[model samples]
Target: MSLFKKKKDELNYLIFEVTRKCNLDCQFCYNHWKRDNDPKAEPVKEGYTFALKTLKTVFKQANPKHVTFTGGEPLLAERVNELILFCRMKGATVSVITNGNTGSTTEFSQLIKVGVQLFELPLHSYDQAVHDRMTGVLGSWKKSKDRMVGLMKFGAYVVPVIVITKQNFSQVGETLELLNNLGFQRVMLNRYNLGGAVLASPEKVLPSKEELNEAFKQANEIAEKRRLQLSSNVCTPHCVVDPNRYRNILFSNCSTEIRQRPLTLTVGGDLRFCNHSPDVMGNIFRETIQTILEKSSEKYSVVARPDFCAGCMRYEKCRGGCRAAAQQTGGSFNDVDPLVNTIKENEETEIA
Candidate 1:
């Protein structure tokens, strides 16, 4: 299935960071790295008017098909509903990535009523203790689980996002079992990148290739047995698993093309080329969207690929893996993805 298709200049996706305040403290939280310098930084409490105007400008400029609200926790933002409604009014489908424990059922229903077509919920483990530990909240497991079910019952398309890490990699099957039992039809497995709060202790969270492959094997089996749809943000080499077994999980990463189309707007209205990187292209509220896009396009006109990937078979599709991953692992955005090295080692082992 073609997940995303857009014209050369059309912006079809917008990921907005609505706020920087979160109720739960996930140890592997990306926001931690984003806001570590000032944990107490205030949320965008009173930016509703400006936010709405800026969003209208974006809608008119890009005519996006989808607008996703994400953040330290988008539900915590005061005007999240308004933003969703505004995007919907502009002919864009809306979605929110939330921890799911912050708001009441009524509030979530209200969001659905306004225009939230999808809700992305994070579920790290089936074991309550492990989940709670990962989230750093004693009761987060129960709250998040209940919230997921509540949203599903409320008639929202709830997609479980499981971030795979050393702490929860071994529980892939159990986690899928819980998701299957919870009546979820699909789950997205996100590979833990060496960014955010984990950067300080990458060794603790980064799973080895063997562990990741094992997790994928178990997850694929469980998903098939349960007849659930499984997708992954982690771009693995084609030879890692049976192509047919992972066909559904496999995805193309056209970072160079995507970098120019999709726009990430921070809560403060800063236009960022990458969510993981703090580099700001421009401020949408201060400048025109066209100008920001032009500046970003010029700046990222050429994404240099690694020398080793010059003639690799997957070069066209994988585009040298994720640039964010490259930067996090090799300390340079243009460096070869560390996964390439791991995949090469795995290939040698298979031949020997």
Candidate 2:
């Protein structure tokens, strides 16, 4: 079977960019690429009635296994609980990614009761000052930390995402220790993808391979010690830091190699390429979910593998590195992943 060909039934994950309004101005927000230059400009909130109506249409056509509600902050959207209830009614597990400062304890509990099974919260570091600085907000650390504990108390599954960057890269171990102490069982160690606002100052934001290697080393050790689950979605080339070396850490395969792709339905009713990339593949209002996935697969195939990746034993596993990262940093999907300096050989077999 052709790699890019996916059955319509294979669509499993869908994201609803519920709103563009956010409370904080993070240094490395992927969505900043589309944000207004004037910070004073009012953020846009999606029409709640229109969103729910469109989502109902989508669910009628195809019920996805997982549906995510995200935005500058999902909680900012009025009547978001109704949307959660709708997804749950459609038999889709619901998740929401938030900055953790928007809603009260009562509001959060209401969301959990309405069927928000999971919440992805961002916690840059254990140090309060560092966390607040990264978020460009004062005292946000306390709110986020308190809310994470509060959500878990409400019986909701919460994953604290640590976006690895030069600023907080050295504090990985400290952050992991804090999460472990807080009783977080699962954590995501994410890489700062080169996109959005960071494109203007990529050097200051993107971590060096050496910085990442050290961070991973700390993460691997702490994960085993604390018995915490550490996973990453960013495509780090195997040559940069082999996943096998860190037995405790889980590095996900690039989606371009997989049959099922995570599709994001933006607030404007358009489907994005993925969560990180700003590229739009199709619109939810105009195209069916199956049609969007099929067209996206064609675009995925166009992303070329790096020349050095040819016949490498791990080629199938890594897919020559993150196509989204390549497109953003190198200006083309065919460009080599910025993290890769040289091809590292596999000990068991030579490159063909």
- Please report the candidate that would top lDDT against the real structure: 2
Q: How does candidate 1 fare on TM-score?
A: 0.85
RMSD of 2: 6.1
lDDT of 2: 0.78
Error of 1 at 5 (Å): 27
Please give each candidate's TM-score.
Answer: 0.85, 0.87
Give the residue spans of candidate 1 off by over 4 A.
1-9, 32-46, 236-245, 259-261, 298-303, 308-311, 328-330, 338-352
Q: On residues 51-143, what C-alpha lDDT tens digit does candidate 1 reach at each position?
A: 676676676556677888988788887777878887888788888999987987778988889868889998899999988888888988888
Model 2 TM: 0.87
The C-alpha lDDT values of all candidates are 0.72, 0.78
RMSD of each: 5.6, 6.1
Q: After superposition, how far is residue 286 of candidate 2 from its true place, in Å?
A: 1.9
For model 2, the run of ten residues with the poorest summed lDDT: 341-350
lDDT of 2 by residue, 119-201 (tens): 99989999999889888899899999999998998899999999998889999999999998998979999877666666667
